[model samples]
Target: MPKSLAEVEEGRTVRIVDVVAGRGAAAMLYNLGLRPGARVEVIRSGPGPVVVRTEGGTFSIGRGLAFKVLVEEEE
Candidate 1:
């Protein structure tokens, strides 16, 4: 059930399963708390940065960074 963040619809809860970390990608996602095993809820996307609400707070993860984080939709 793992899918790239770009494949996930906004307003759904997803569990972070993997990350394709790179220099910019790592810092972007890490700053937004998108590491493996982290639970994130996709809030709003498109025409702007993809937003994710997590334990710490609401964070806007850009599509470029979002694509690197693989997540499974929560049931």
Candidate 2:
């Protein structure tokens, strides 16, 4: 099932399914290499920002931004 990036736990790897943000936010994420089908490992997720690491690099996505990122857990 797809879930917001903010809801994923640390150490879990997920594949980005979609980004439910406006053009600007989506474009920002896209520039960070967080587009659909991109795989990322959650480094931290809680009250603060949701940190994720992908092939491109690590990113600290704010809670609001994290919620806009829909992802599915990787098997």
Candidate 3:
């Protein structure tokens, strides 16, 4: 099932299924290497920023922004 990146547990690797953000937000995420089909590992998920590691690099996403990223568990 698809869930928000913020909902994903730490240490879990997930594939970005969709971005439910506005154009600007989507573009920003895209620029940060977080677009649809991108595979990212949840480095941290909690009250603070959600950290994700991708092939490009690692990023700290804000709660609101992370919530807009739809992801599915990998494996």
Candidate 4:
């Protein structure tokens, strides 16, 4: 099942499935190396921004944007 990135726990790796946001938000996330098919490791997910590591680099995405990023946990 697909879940928002913000809900993913630390140490878990997930594949981005979709981004439910406007063009600007989507573009911003894409520029940050987050897009459908991309894989990200949850570095930190808590009260603050959710931090993730991708093939490009590590980044901190605010909870708002993180909620728009849908992903499936990787085995």
Worst 10 residues of 3 by lDDT: 66-75
Q: Estimate each model's TM-score.
A: 0.82, 0.97, 0.96, 0.95
Best by TM-score: 2
Mark the regions of model 4 whose C-alpha exceeds 4 Å error after superposition. Answer: none
For model 4, the run of ten residues with the poorest summed lDDT: 25-34
TM-score-sorted candidate list, best first: 2, 3, 4, 1
lDDT, each prediction: 0.81, 0.95, 0.95, 0.95
RMSD of 1: 1.8
Model 4 per-residue lDDT tens digits across residues 3-60: 9999999999999999999999999988877999999999999998999999999999
The deviation in Å at residue 8 for candidate 3 is 0.6
Residue-level lDDT of model 2, residues 13-61, one tens digit each, is: 9999999999999999999899999999999988999999999999999
Show the colliding residue pairs in model 1: none
* lDDT tens per residue, model 3, 1-75: 899999998999999999999999899999988999999999999998999999999999999999999999988
Model 4 vs. true fold: TM: 0.95
